[model samples]
Structures are given as C-alpha cells and as structure tokens.
Target: MTSTHADAHILVSMTYASRANPNVSATDFNEILQQAQINNAANSITGMLTFNKDYFLQTIEGPRAQINRLLYILISDERHHDLQIIDTRELKHREWAKWSMNYASPTEENAAIYLKYSTTIGFNPYLLNAESAHGLMNELSAQKG
Candidate 1:
C-alpha cells in the first residue's frame, strides 16, 4: 500500500554493520551514495549516512512507506547485516532535502553527538547530530569537480 505524509515527514535512524564482503570498499560506498542520489531525486526522499569503522548510521526521510521500503532494501542487502532501528520521529520539514544521502566519516566531533543519542536510546549512536554530521558531506561536495 502507498503511504503519504500530508503535513509531516517520517524520519528513521538505523544502524547496520558491513558483511565483511571483499567487494565492499570505500568505492562501493561512493557508488551507493550515487545510487541514493538518483533514487532520491526521482522520489523526493532525503537522508544522510555516517560511518565509523565498520558501523553505519543513517537517517531517512520521506513518505512513511517509501522510507520504510528503502530501509528494508538497505537492511536486507547482502553487503550489510545486523540491522537495528535506533530511532524514529516525524518532522515538520525535510532536514536533508537537497541531498539523497550525505555521507560522513565519523570523527571525534561527530562522535560526541552520536554518543549522547546512543546513551539515551540504549544503543551505540552510529550516527551523529545532523548539524555536525554534515561537515564531512560539505567537504565531499567541495572536492567534487
């Protein structure tokens, strides 16, 4: 069934671990980001991704079913496993409207926010706050020719 958000957007924070696949590397990650952008452009979905070591934290926003379907595909993909739902909320506006997936390499600054949320949610925050999390993404965009 198709689901739509009339006055708000559904936000989902999820955590997953890579499957130790030999094919899964930084380049593969970049390709995933490109694919996400294509999908988001067509669907008007938005989100961000943060990675620390082998753990991944992501937030997706869109129609409820669309976001859930995307998450399902991500969690079910063979390249990742141990999928966990960290948090979910309804937002009045789209936080990452311009990008389908903003990617960040986790660092000390970002970890602070991730740790705080992790403590509150009883799970390790694989993702940082949207504010700090976007720094890496901005850097990535700057490097693109």
Candidate 2:
C-alpha cells in the first residue's frame, strides 16, 4: 500500500526561521508577502509571519503536501538564507485559520511582546520553544486586532 496526497488528510503546522538577506528591500518583502497570501489562500493554507530587520519567523498550517511545497519554496528563495525549521506538528485545528498569511514586524509598541517570547529584548525565533513560538504569534495576532 502507498500513500498519496489524497490519502493524506492530516493538517500540519510548520514553524520556521530564517535570516533575511541584507539586500532585500521593502518592496521585495512586500512582494513576497503578497505572493504568499495569494498562494496560501488558494491552497487552503493559513499562517502568520513575523520579522525584524534581520530575521523572519513564520508558522503555517495546511495539508501536508502544501506545507511540503512551501518548505521547498522557502529553501530555494534567495530573499532569505540559513533557513531553520523550528517545529512541525500534526494539528487538530489551525491556530490562525482566519489568516491566509497574517504578518507582523516588531515595533516599539509591541517590543515587550517579543521580549516575552525571547530570552533577550530582541526577537529571535531560533531560541524559542515550539510552544513559545506559537504563543508569540498568537499574542502578535491579538495586537494586530
């Protein structure tokens, strides 16, 4: 017996972090966000992206195949490098189902929220536990509202 995309019905969530390419301009980041929202919504994916000047942290949930395809795209994208997957899990329901790709960039108003999830004042997803990473996104989402 073999499993295929049709046979894989489980929803999965993936959390990852990457160092942003220094040369990537605001226009480039906006384009990436726009593309991700369009692609994710079309594929029934939902997620949140958080970034600072130096890094990107994101959590995405969807069908296994779509998530895998996203991972592949992330690996090949030149806008960022040193991609690291922080966690992957089979999900019962999406944490951010309402968002195709909600985005957040740290501001002074929310700096404390980032600090709550990080060991230091700066936001660093690599240092975060899976639980904290999701918690951080949830908090950020609340702030967005």
Candidate 3:
C-alpha cells in the first residue's frame, strides 16, 4: 500500500556537524549527492540537504524503519559527526516530496536564504533550533532546482 505524509510513520529533521571530515572537493561532494539520490529513491526516502562551510542541516521524511536505517548509516559514516535529531513528529504532508535528495550549498547569490535563519547571517547550525533548522533547509531547497 502507498503512504501519504500523514500515514507515513515518521518525519525527521536534523542538523549535524561536518567538521569531522576533511574538506570535500566538488567531485567528492557530487559523488555523495549522486549516491544519495539513488539510494533514497530505492528506499522511498525524501529530504533536503543544506551545507555551508561548517554544518549540514537536513530534513528527511519516510517510513520509520527506513528513516531509522538511514540514521544508523549516517551515524556510522565518518564523513560527518555530532548528528543531532532536532525534531521528530507526525506531519500531514511532506515538505520535500518532489526530490529524493534535493541539496544546496551556500553561494554568494544564495547566501541570503541560508543566512535568514542565522542570527549573524552565518551558516552555523549550532546556533539554530529545530524550527530554524527546518526553515534553513526549506530556504535552501528553494534556492535552485
């Protein structure tokens, strides 16, 4: 049976640190995005990823089991650290249903969207709460495709 957002088991929103890994080059980042799109599509997962110089804030929604599985993988992945689940709740609709993994990196043209949630216009996830984190992801997702 198919599931609507309300019928879905979970909707998770999280923010995490990315400083645990070495600087990612464009090739490496693109590779990660490619893999995420493939994997997320297969698993019925949908999310948006927003990254700046220091942190990664993502919002993922899908089956509870699948989300849990992804979370496990993320925790074990050494590419990032300090995974923080900022919000978890049942929702009526998926905010990012259009893409398996829509992503955005702050740039000169789009820094404003990413910085709207930050107090100092810096892309620091640590200074944000669950609401702001979700907002940040939403803004980033709206930046481009």
Best by lDDT: 2
Q: Clash totals for all models, in order?
A: 0, 0, 0
The models' CA-based lDDT, in order, is 0.59, 0.88, 0.72
As for lDDT, the candidate ahead, 2 or 3, is: 2
List candidate 2 segments past 4 Å from native. 1-5
lDDT of 3 by residue, 1-145 (tens): 3434553555544344444366666676677788889999998888887776566777778777677778889888777777777777665677778999999887887877765777874667777887777777766666675
Q: Report the Cα lDDT for candidate 3.
A: 0.72
Which prediction has more favorable TM-score, 1 or 2?
A: 2
| Per-residue lDDT of model 1, residues 39-109, tens digit only | 87776688776654456666677766677678778877776667666556666677677677766664555
Residue 28 accuracy (lDDT) in model 1: 74
- TM-scores of the candidates are 0.63, 0.92, 0.82
Give the Å error, residue 1, model 1: 6.1
Q: Which has the greatest TM-score?
A: 2
Name the runs in model 1 displaced over 4 angstroms. Answer: 1-23, 106-145
lDDT of 2 by residue, 14-86 (tens): 9999999999888888998999999998888899999988899999899888888889989999999999998
Ranking by lDDT: 2, 3, 1
Which residue pairs show collisions in model 1?
none
* Residue-level lDDT for 49 in candidate 3: 77
